[model samples]
Target chain A: MNRAPGLKTYAVIYLLFLYGPILILPLFAFNDASIVAFPLAGFTTKWFAEMWADPNLWKALKNSLIIALSTATLSTVLGIFAARSSVRYKWPGKPVVMGFIMLPLVLPEMIVAMSLLIVLLGIGINLSIFTVIMGHVLMCTPFAVAILTSAFQSLDRSLEEAALDLGESAASTFRLIILPLVMPGILSSFLITFTISIDEFIVANFLGSGQPILSVYIFGQFRFPAKVPSMLALGTILVGVSVVLLAIAEYFRRRGIARTGGKDTGGFL
Target chain B: MTFSPDRPTMIEFRDVHKYYGDYHALRGINGTIRAGEFFSLLGPSGCGKTTLLRTIAGFEGIDNGAVLIDGKDMAKVPANARPTNMVFQSYAIFPHMSVAENVGFGLRRDPRSRTEKAAAVEEALEMVGLKGYGARAAHALSGGQRQRVALARALILKPKVLLLDEPLSALDKKMREHMQVELIKLQRQVGITFILVTHDQEEALVMSDRIAVMFEGQIAQLADPETLYRRPNGRKVADFIGTMNFIPCQILSETGGRIEVEAKGLGRVMLDEDQVPPARGEGEPVVGLRPETLTMLYPGQEPQERAVAGRIDEVIYFGDMTYYDVFIGGTDVEVRLSMRNVPGRPVLDVGTEVQLAWSPSALVLFR
Candidate 1:
């Protein structure tokens, strides 16, 4: 095939436009100057040290970790039930129910946060980290269900029937066969939901009342010009963590497909 | 034809019927499968063969009939509680488990100790010619090996009846033929009543002691393989089982224990009472003859009782046997006949005038 002139250059520019800003975070984080701008600055680790010593930053990190962990576990558990029933059984109103479950994936996060704040306040529930966790779960569950549903759908129906024919009860068959086959999918779901909850800004900012959260705290620190360099360092670390976590998730997803002897029908890379 | 008269019944379907929404899957199936017999439910697809097999395994529930296994009503029994096991069409080997784990899966509820169960798994594996394969991953095995594993897994439990649903359909031709003999031997050694569901007529004829041919969710005929091939109850069963050349005929007279019919190009002949099956009102009266029953005689060879003058219209060579479609006796009726390719005999060519020899006893009148 003859190449179109400048196609390669166009591709390179397109990729740069998508990710060039993310590449800038680490560069500015390591720069020695306080101002985030051009002109070469000498290297320094002082901003990283400053970030490590902040007590308020540590508090916010602890709160974010708790919320992300809780949201990941709860949403993945709910996803298993929803995906299993949706894939295996037929019932009245199934499409409508599944549609409602997946609606939060496309619903704007700002609107979701505003309505949830109104409902929680109107119900007389005090805002806390727990409320922030609830909001994150609602937002993350649709993603978990989408991933796990494909995993469950790839399984052969005869495998379950063969187990039952071999005298295994329904529950034992699920524990022995169904759970192990879809374990990698569960891991992928957990990692994705955890990543979503950790970086989530709108819901965490609106629902946490006055509690310290990493996203909200980072937003507040932007008011101080001198604190900007340390915040950039923290952002650089977050980017590195996200990349590693997603890589691990993709690895397990590929391994699961290999274990089942199924074709790699592309997955999240 | 080899079935004895004294064996007890293992499974019985009493007017079973099944439905899937508006589609009637199994209309009303009634039959009995004898103990220690290798039985088959044979039909084309959508003929309710698999549905009937599942009803015995308790995987499917009939709408208005009873399925009895070993004289016990299985209406309330779940699939896991039934005394029957199935080798699925896909074999359904657990991709995540080793061969040993899959074979011993059903032993979880057994009262035996661990080592004793392990020995039993080994014995089952040996029975299926997969003795040293228990440690290998199931996903790595070939199609034939997976079928063997599925067999060993189902037979290890020693169920009263074993159900197989087209277990050899996934293999190539050579492998499928090899497994058919193995399945027959395994069925005999275990002495468990085996029921197989297959859409391939040849597979059913080769592996089953008796076969129940189904059509449109009902049992069209149930008899031994030899009887099914030799004396099908109607034209539909006769056509489905093998190649039968149907020639138009007219009933001339009926006598005591005899039926006189004038067949096309073959002249008049008298048929025995057994040769005339009960009328099914299918179509016009016709006489059916198997291709192998008719033989082409060479020059100076004597006819076996009766002979019809025929001209060879088409010749199909099958290595050892040659099939010729002959237009018999100044008529447009073409019937196929097979002749053995002996060392001294020559293959007949098209447009050759040959005398086709057939007997009156081989003719089955379907009216």
Candidate 2:
């Protein structure tokens, strides 16, 4: 297929516009000078050392890890139930139920955080890391369900029947056949939900209530000009972690497709 | 076709009925499958053949009847607890497991030691012509190999009855034909009651000792392959089994044990009482003849029994045999007949005048 030279130039410019800011983080992170300016400063590891020394940074990282891990585990478990039932069985109002479960994916994050805040307050619940985890789970479960549903849908129903015909009970068939086949999908869902929860700012800001979550703590650090270089160092490290996580998730997703002998369709990668 | 009539009943369905909401899937199914016999449920799609087979495997429950295996009622039997195994149409080989793991999946609860189970898995694999293939991953195998693995997996349990649901449909034509003969031989070697469900009439006829022809949730006829081909009970069964030329006929008289009919293009003929199957309330009566039953007499050849004058309307040449469509007896009725492409007999062109020889015993009267 032939493409016009003008279209090629436009695509290059579009990609540069998208990724140019992210590319500046590591460059500024390694600079010796604290001020993030154009002229190349001598490379140094001082910002990473400074960032590592802050006790509050460690606390925020711990809190964020707890929230992200909890959200990933809870939402993925819920997603397995919802996805399997949606794919393998028929019931009244199925579409309506699935639609409601997926509605959070499209709802604005600010609205969701605000609504969850109001509900938690009305129920006399304390705002803490636990509440932030709850809000993040609500925000991430739709993504988990969407990923796992495709995995369940690709499975052939006859495999389960064949297992049962071979004298395995329903529960044993699920343990021996269904769980192993969809393990890759479950791993993918866990990684994606963890990444989404860790990087989310609005929900963490609204629900943490000064709990020092990592994303909210980063936003606060930006207010102090002296902390900018260390924050850039942290951002660079985060970008690397997110890339590796998504790469692993995509690998598992592709492996799941191949294991089922299914054609690869669109995925997060 | 070595089925003995004295064999004991393995599975019996008494007034079996199944409904999917408003659609009645199986309407009062009644039949008995004999032990050690190769049986088939043959029908087109949506005819409940697969549903009926599932009933025997205990995968489907009948709404109004009892399913008996070995003279015991199976009303409360679940699929996992039943004494039947199935080879699915998709083969359903577990993609995550090795071929040996899949074949020995049913033996998970067996009391045999590890080495004993391994030997049994090897033996089952050899039974399906898949020895030494057990070490490979299932997803790496081809379609025909997957089918063999599924067969071995199901047969390893030594179930009282083995159900095969269109097991050869996914393979190429040559592979399907090859598997058909293999399945028949395996059924004989094991002497297990095999119940096959297929929409392919030729496959069912080639493999089964007896077959039940079904249409729209009802069995039209349950008989051996030769009886089904020579004497179908209804026009629909006749049409579905193979290519049959239906010629309009009028019943001249009915006697105590004979039926006389004046068939179009063939004049009057006397048929035995058994040749006339029970009426299915179909449209005008017709006499059906298979394409192979009618012989096209070449020039200077004598008619064996009866002959009719026909003009060759069309000639379809196959490598070993040729099919000729001829209009018979100065009438508009066209009947297709097959003639062998033999030495000294040239392929006749269209519009050639020919003599077609047929026997009255081969005609089935359907009303």
Candidate 3:
């Protein structure tokens, strides 16, 4: 409830700084001129059309979609279990387990990506979309787990206990009671992991070969002037998709907040 | 080994002991809760009342001995395997489930068809007076409605016993009063044993058929509410269960069914402690009385016949009764009287000389 002055300033500054560049992507994508530089050129949609016409672009988009979907599914299922156990039980090594789950979030992304690449190479796992999926799953699972752990932690464990006392078996009780209760947190975790997997650059860059992802494709397009605006169009679309996904993520996040009796503060006190 | 079908023994804690690591939670406790009895484990917080209730609910494992439900040992029985259910202190209503879904949650084992289960859910919801609120999510309902949903969910399974952990502690005063009466009626209709855990003595007194007063993880006294309140086992039991005014006294003589005590400040008083054990020739014996049993100060009363001479030092005026802290012969003693706000309470201000008196029978003698 406290509307402390300093945090409000920090929050205002953070929102503008984080969102300013992404907002500019859509504006430039619509710019008519091929060259993306200073000077107002009239608006056009040719780059978008140009991007659609490219076969390579389509293949990359398809590959990214497959990878992101698989990654999200893999991460979400694992995340749900990991989060539930981490929050619900008091195992002897719980602290160590939590630290391991959160390591990816705190560790540098490049280090994790590089380590995964080297580990995959050592195990003779080839560089491909499969490898890319594994990499994204690895990078995204931690985020998924972290997001979900918070969600599960906020829910009262007594609901599950109540269900069990009413004679629902452990497995069915989870399906019938705990899952529904933490669904908002579960969904936000899914979308966030999906977004992270789709938007990831390093793992896809290091692991993808013979199958380039959207991030890799976008990076390749940065060199050619003819491909610049088209890439800008592609980037614009990705940004919009990401924003929409993030917005949906935010929706579920807000829903989870509201569902758990979260504070209705404009900002944290 | 099993109870009869007519008057069943629904739940029994047979020498049950629970330990959380090294700390003993429920000591070798043995008790049986009959079907259709409203029983309360009354105690201060940390007295392991909740732990004992949880052990019956299958949430906590008994470290030793067995908790029996329908004469079956529950030591190895998981919570989900037991037919007993609980309404947690927080109500524990599934926030995601609508009122109907929550009620139907336990009906998964219904021998009836899905449609019949659905109908049963409706019946349970209606039983709790939440008939029309089936579709609304649990979080949307008010606190009282959620509590009913919790009750309905537990009841739908037709559990032999229902464990309620301080179920009314979270409610507002008016809501709690209304619910207490409703709960009694609901229990009568269901005819299942209700094992309730609460620290609120008044709540235990009002709702329970029998109250077990616990102290430091042990049941100090277990009896009907009337006996528990009136003839508490000792000074600790007396002090814990209700308000008491205790003062140092000397045992003058012991006889059948009665003993005379010479209280230091108060005059000779008579007490009945069931044959009055041989007098303790010790540091100090004490006489106690419940505040409600003592009468108020009166100017016209005989000064010499009264228990003590004292000045009323403080007056704590509760709406129903006014309590006076009197300085009787240098020892401060408290007395309470039901107020008749005619000329208002016998306006005894601080530092005022007041002569307090009590009948000899009111002197509750204790060593």
Candidate 4:
């Protein structure tokens, strides 16, 4: 309530600066004119129609979905193992090993893509959608591990022990108790990794070769000035989809917290 | 003090020893827990009381010796296959399940029909005074309710031994007292061996049929509650269980099962062999006496036993009881005496002269 007026205005300006370009995408996507300049362009649905009718865009979308889903599944599954061990056990040189695993989160994506491309070529491997998936998985696993580790840490150690003591084997205990408790964290990790993989440009461009990836195809579409309006329409739809996906992930995360009677610390809403 | 010869030993530990890294825990433990008896392992923290209980439940393995349950060696059995169940201190009610689900969790592998298993769950809930609570969510229950659910869960299995690891430590004082009586009644109803691990001396004394007093990973003494409080085996055991005033003394003579010692404040006394614990350490011998055994005489009261002249130095008043720290005549030592506050009796002030009366049989010489 006592917020300074100067600081309040600065925060408002800061938010507008961050989201100003995104707000313009929907504006132009529904505008009657192809020109992006303001002057009250009338509303029209032609650009959205054009974006939906493109066969090449549909093919690229299919390829991106396959890579994102595969990357999300593989990274999250591997993340569970890494996160569980890191949270529950102590080992020598663990810091160094985990550092290497998380290095991709901060390392420049272009450098990682270049190194991976050179490695793939040196090994006589052909670059394709599979290659793109491998790159995306590598980039997304660190996020998955970080998220899942917090989930595993919030769980009580005695719950698993109680199940085991009550005549359940170790495997069954994990399946019945551990899985249900951490399932929310797993879903969040998968959604976040999926979002990261779908829009990834550097790795898809470098490792995908001539294969049609949505990000690479969108970049190619920008070469022609006529396709600019339709690209804006596509960007608007993607923004809506991303917002809905985040809302859904947050919903499940909150429900998971409630199911386990845990307090809600801030999550990725 | 007297155990029936017909009651079988339900569990036995023979020279059990355990070590964590370089720290020795559970050093050569040997004891027998009788069938259908309420046994307690009482000790301070890091005394390996919980470790010993866990060994019986198959949660821990001994470095040497064997744990025998129902006269069979349990060295190879895992915890899931063991014939013991534990009510954990935290209650450990599965947060995601209903109360009925949590209670009936152990019954998942039971080959009985669904109706029979449901009936059993209902019976267990009723046994713990949680009737009509099967439909409630586990996380919504209170602390006392959670404890009852945990009890029902462990009891539903009908394990040979029910282990409780400080189950009442989490409750408030009033709730803890209520649960103590409830647990005793429940144990009698179930007719199974109950093993409790607790650091609270009062709780152990109130609930246990036999208590094993552990110190630094070793059983110092195992006896009934009265004997443990009255004739603690060592200085440490006596000091840990309750308040005792130790008077340094000199051993004058030793006869058949009798020893005479000249105590500092209480003068000379003859102690039978049962009244004397095994002598430990060197230098001067000592005799230990409980606070309640020593009494202060009011005006016009004749001493029924031998009396010592003393002056009250400090008065600690409780609502129903008062403890007076009295300094004996011609000695630097002070002894505490607790007296119940009767309606017509007056609370003695500090520095008031009084005669303290005590019996010779109540003194335990520790040399």
DockQ of each: 0.83, 0.80, 0.59, 0.74
User: Top lDDT: which candidate number?
Assistant: 1
**Model 3, residue B37: C-alpha shift (Å):** 1.9
Q: Where does model 2 exceed 4 Å of error?
A: A252-262, A266-269
Give Cα-based local distance difference scores for all models. 0.93, 0.92, 0.79, 0.92
- Order the candidates by lDDT, highest first — what do you get? 1, 2, 4, 3
* TM-score of decoy 4: 0.96
What lDDT is reached at residue A159 by model 3?
80
Cα lDDT tens digits, model 4, A150-244, are: 99998888787788789999899999899998999899899989999999999999999988899999999999989999999999999999999
Candidate 4 lDDT for residue A209: 93
Question: Candidate 2's residue-wise lDDT over A67-107, tens digit each?
Answer: 99999999999999999999999999999999999999999
Among all windows of 10 consecutive residues in model 3 chain B, the one with the lowest summed lDDT is B274-283
Which candidate comes out best when scored by DockQ?
1
- Model 4, span B1-367: residue lDDT tens: 3445368999999999999889899899999999999999999999999999989888788899999999999999998999999999888889999999999999999999999999999999999999999999899899999999999999999999999999999999999999999999999899899999999999999999999999898999999999999998888888889899988988999998899999998888989999988747734678889999998887778888889999888999998999999898658889988999998889988888999889998898887
lDDT of 1 by residue, B149-267 (tens): 99999999999999999999999999999999999989889999999999999999999999999999999999988899999999999999999999999999999869899999999
Q: How accurate is candidate 4 locally (lDDT)?
A: 0.92
Model 1 lDDT per residue over A197-252, tens place:
99899999999997999999999999999999999999999999888888888998
Where does candidate 2 chain A have its weakest 10-residue lDDT segment? A259-268
Alpha-carbon DockQ of candidate 4: 0.74
Chain A TM per prediction:
0.95, 0.93, 0.85, 0.97
Per-residue CA lDDT of model 3 for B1-367, tens digit only, reads 1223356677777787778889987888887777778889999999999998888888888778888888899888888878788999989877666678777877767788988888888889899999888888777888899899999988988888888999998899999999999998898899888888989898888888888888787887777777767666667767887787778777788787677878867777777755233333423677767776655556676634455667777777766556777767666544443333346456567888765666665566667
True contacts kept of each: 0.91, 0.93, 0.82, 0.64
Per-model TM-score versus the true fold: 0.97, 0.97, 0.88, 0.96
